[model samples]
Target: MYVYDEFDRAFLAERVAEFRDQVARRLSGALSEDEFKPLRLMNGVYLQLHAYMLRVAIPYGTLSSDQLRRLAYVARTYDRGYGHFTTRQNIQFNWIKLEDLPDAMAALAEVGVHGIQTSGNCIRNVTTDQWAGATPQEFDDPRIWAEILRQYSTLHPEFTYLPRKFKIAITAAPKDRAATKVHDVGLRLHRNEAGELGFEVLVGGGLGRTPFVGKSVRAFLPARHLLSYIEAIMRVYNQYGRRDNIYKARIKILVHEIGAEAFAKAVEAEWEAIRDGALHLSDEIIADIRSRFLYPDFQPRADQPAALATALEDPAFAAWHRNSVHPHKVPGHAIVTVSLKAIGAPPGDATADQMEVVAALADDFGWREIRVGHEQNLCLPNVAQEDLPAIWRRLEAAGLATPNVNHISDIIACPGLDYCALANARAIPVAQEIAKRFADLERSRTIGRLHVNISGCINACGHHHVGHIGILGVEKNGQEFYQITLGGRADEHAQLGTLLGPAVSYEQVPGLIEDVVDTYIELRAGPDELFIDTVARLGVEPFKERVYAAH
Candidate 1:
């Protein structure tokens, strides 16, 4: 993890002091709720239903062991003894007292973490593929660029109050695990034909009441121009972004209203104006930032191949092999995703003790590195392949071993009624019930790599709009109802889901999901075809016809 510099330190200190004053004023009734709302939000404080929710930025999902320990301390001391990791590679504490928030903020600042840019109309946390540094296919570590953006965007005076909140995600992996297409701005990093690293810039992608998969504004943006290009985009948004209606506030709405070609032209015009500004990334600056991300030492390992062969024999290890593990960049190293979706537990709630265990696992197993994936899972990037069984056993004992990484049961759901004041229904219970319905490993694995996202409301916090099969909870006659949609995805070929049928009762949700899955099982070309691919090829007709079938 990159350590904070004097600049970063000073900025955070000043911002914390500023927020301390804001909190004091709000408490003293000097500022009305409406006035305090935006100010508090800019500082990453939210007035939730039960208590103030504080969302701390975990940039690009990279956390040092020390940072993890501090997070555990926050959970233990201030809030409850746990914290919730969110879908966009951030964490939220649901139980924060206003009185203790200042102390919490100071503690967080001590560890180079903060609530700034975690919420509000400025650019939120710069997220990336959890596997960035350790992945084999990456052109370069996207986290480097993400950090650059973090410094540039945090409390940026110009974009402090944009028309709406902005989000940016970068990924260098061939696989689109970060769902770059569904962000306000998405950067897919890759090397060009000449082997020069660059980015594919997409703008205006987001999901709310309306959803759009952003269009490509620049196909090949060299790394040095990253901040310059981003500045260009932000300037265009600030200048022309709509403030007439909150619903149309997002840049996605702006991108839709103005075609991609015209938007690109506008951004290009702005890019030309400030191409060589102070924000322009120079080689010396890049080298300094890049130095902080130096790879860990790896001793030559002659013992790895045989160890991996030994791991294949254990059934439990084999189960993990088929699920939560991936190939790593190092010779004897393997990528491991520590599944947080254990049965009956919240998807990403790691106990303080468990957090410590993860820290230990990262330290003892490989480099002192850890990654918080966008899918609410943790990634151990360079574990020795030979120790797979032992690691799996330890994770199992710690309740961190659930072999359902990309399988159907590994659903991504929002905190919903459990945490959010904006939610209309309880997504956790519904998700839990659906998990129960598909608990059979054989059945789930047979279905394969399906993303089922559930949102409690149309705000789409759970990203249901991008799931292969999406579920949105709504209130009908004061009763909770769920609307199912099919064919949605957030990869390069991103598309919002189309509704399947009328909203179903909460009681009938599991059955409806079963019907949809069953229909996919019947109509899919083969077991190899995942739900999204099959749905795209076959359309939603089969699933819809079966789900809403007249009995």
Candidate 2:
């Protein structure tokens, strides 16, 4: 975790005070709703269908226990008893009172947290792999660069008001857990033949009404030139990105229109102009940034404890271990994903009580640290293998241990028509119903790694374009209907899903999903074949035929 310095504290204080005054003005009628819109958005506040929503940034998805406790306090005191963790690894409070906005910001500031850049037509939160530091396969920690970007872009005058919201994601691992392909700018940290670290930069990737998998603009950019090259990309976007229509404003549109080759050429010219400029990161600066991040002290343990092996005898424990547990870089350690998507519950939501329980878990079993994953789950990144049973018991009791990571029920759904004014259909009920349809734990496991992402609209907030089974809510003849897509994935081999058939009524969704899964089961080579693998082997035609045949 990166601790806030004195400068960070002062900046947050100033920003909070500024927003406080703005909020007061709006409440006092000095500022009208239209006048307050951008101001509120800049501060991460949104006026949703029912109430004000506040999105707080969890940069790179890392949180100390104290920070987690502060978030829990805010959820308990300011809004509803729970908050929604988003696909981008940030958290949202859907029922924030307008007047309490400043107070909430001030409270969050006390723990080096804020809602800055969470919304608006600016560079949003810089996200990275949730398993950044702990994952074994990573070449280096991507959080270091994410933090560097955070500092550089926080209030960068040049990019403060881009044509549209800009997102950048980085991953050090070979596995694209960060969904780099779907970001405005995706940086993959890897080495060239010489074994020197650098980034494989991708641009023009995004999802909305129009979706694009980012194209590689640079095969190998030296790590030291990261900032300059990124600035070059930003400069290109700011210079030529559309400003006439919001729909065509994103960099992806520009990249698509101009073509990746021309975009790369323009970016290259800009990079040549500033590659050695002030933005160039030096070795000392990189080291300084690295020092700011906290790393856990690990004791040398060559093997897992005997208790862990014994605990595997319990069927429930064994199931959880198989599903929730992941490999860690440290010996005798594991990364445990606490599934927020319990069957029949809204995905990514955690009650204040559950938040506190997770905080306690971080303190007791984990290294007093927690990570918010892109999959809308909480991660204990530094848990000892010996303590898995104890952690599992606690999580199970808290209703946090569903053992459904990467499974059908571990859905990613947005706050659709239920909360968003922009939504066309209700996503929560459909997601809930679908989860209920597959409530059997063993059945879900047998079904295997199926990512069902749902969005209320075409904004793609739930990342529906990249789910194994994507359900997008649409309005037809003034009725809620869903358009389904199959075979989409957000991993290293990221690809947009193919549309199955015509939009189906909300009542047909759960059954449609069930039919698709059944079709996969019937067609798959074996139980070990993943849903994605099966979809790749045989395209969406098979699943589409089965789903629409019944519908």
User: Per-prediction RMSD in angstroms?
Assistant: 1.7, 0.9
lDDT of 1 at 326: 87
- Strongest candidate by TM-score: 2
Every model's TM-score: 0.96, 0.99
lDDT of 1 by residue, 221-333 (tens): 98899999999999999999999999988999888998999999999999998888887889999988888775778766654578677877888778888798887777777
Task: Name every residue pair that clashes in candidate 1.
Answer: none
* Residue 57 displacement in candidate 2 (angstroms): 0.5
Worst 10 residues of 2 by lDDT: 296-305
Q: Write the per-residue lDDT of candidate 2 for residues 260-311, one digit (tens) a residue.
A: 9999999999999899989989999999999999898998765568999899
Reference-based lDDT, each prediction = 0.86, 0.93
Q: Compared to the true structure, candidate 2 yields what TM-score?
A: 0.99
